[model samples]
Target: MSPSFRPRAPRPGPVKTQEELDEMVRRMKGEQKAPDNYRERSLKLHGWICAKCGREFDLANLHLLTVHHKDGNHNYNPPDGSNWENLCVYCHDDEHSRSILADYLRGDNRKK
Candidate 1:
């Protein structure tokens, strides 16, 4: 004869009050660090022009400008802005596509 299987019930955790929940949320918010503003820093260092195409930009079209990491590492931002270049959307797309094509041709399918 086979024994019937039964699952164990979940253990109940201590319930937090509304004030406790709010305090926990407040503590989490306080512990969070401000996001890196590397784009603005790169723009300031490299100027408002595309590095590849030399396309100029103004306040109106500044949104189209993007910061490209030279080493392709987003987390490798330096305060000196050594690894960043300002590129327009078109040039940035071309730059990434070229790299992808190169990797494909070299049979290197690893994500960077």
Candidate 2:
């Protein structure tokens, strides 16, 4: 070891108050596994059928179907589910790939 090289002392971060810690825990619990109302509504509105592949889903394989945002804006949910479609996981991946391909053709190299 070089005598000139000294190890730096460990620094402590700013401590949160007990109230802040409690609030952080509460927020984490609320957001960690919250369900989306739009997904639930879309399922009820459109049923468990893939719009692209026309595959039907029931409670046995309901997880295979997913709600897709038509305009690619997930936050732009409509009450009528007009911007939402039920798609199988495979079709959803293909849909996103097509979107990416379109963007690439237009010289937009951003990855989604």
Candidate 3:
């Protein structure tokens, strides 16, 4: 049999101590940037109301409220809140469904 056909044993790597592993994890976490709080900023700027259905939201039911990007680009958030719209869960679903249907009708097979 050729050398290429021979099975090779796995190479052993240096095992890390618990303290070393913990330190590595801590350094990784520290190096990571905090997630953007655009949702909170959008809620503050556009009030707690759905732009499409005009449904209002309060602290108790604020979970149903979501921030939507007007231009369909999630990364195109502006500080002035021009591209963001506060939408209720139902309206948000409907808005996405309409866009999907429109795209289907137009034969847009490209994934968004």
The numbered model that scores best in lDDT is: 1
Number of the predicted model whose TM-score against the real structure is largest: 1
Which segments of model 2 are wrong by more than 4 Å?
A: 1-36
Question: lDDT (0-100) at residue 37 of candidate 3?
Answer: 86
Q: Rank the models by TM-score, top first.
A: 1, 3, 2
Global lDDT of each candidate: 0.96, 0.91, 0.92
Candidate 1 per-residue lDDT over residues 84-103, each given as its tens digit: 99999999999999999999
Model 3 spans with C-alpha error above 4 angstroms = 1-32
- Over 44-105, each residue of candidate 2 has an lDDT whose tens digit, in order, gives 99998999999999899998899999988988988989999999999999999998898899
Q: What is the per-residue lDDT of model 3 for residues 9-50, given as tens digits with 9 covering 90 to 100? A: 878999889999999999999999988788999999999999
Q: List the residue pairs that clash in candidate 1.
A: none
Q: How many backbone clashes does candidate 3 have?
A: 0
RMSD of model 3, in Å? 4.3
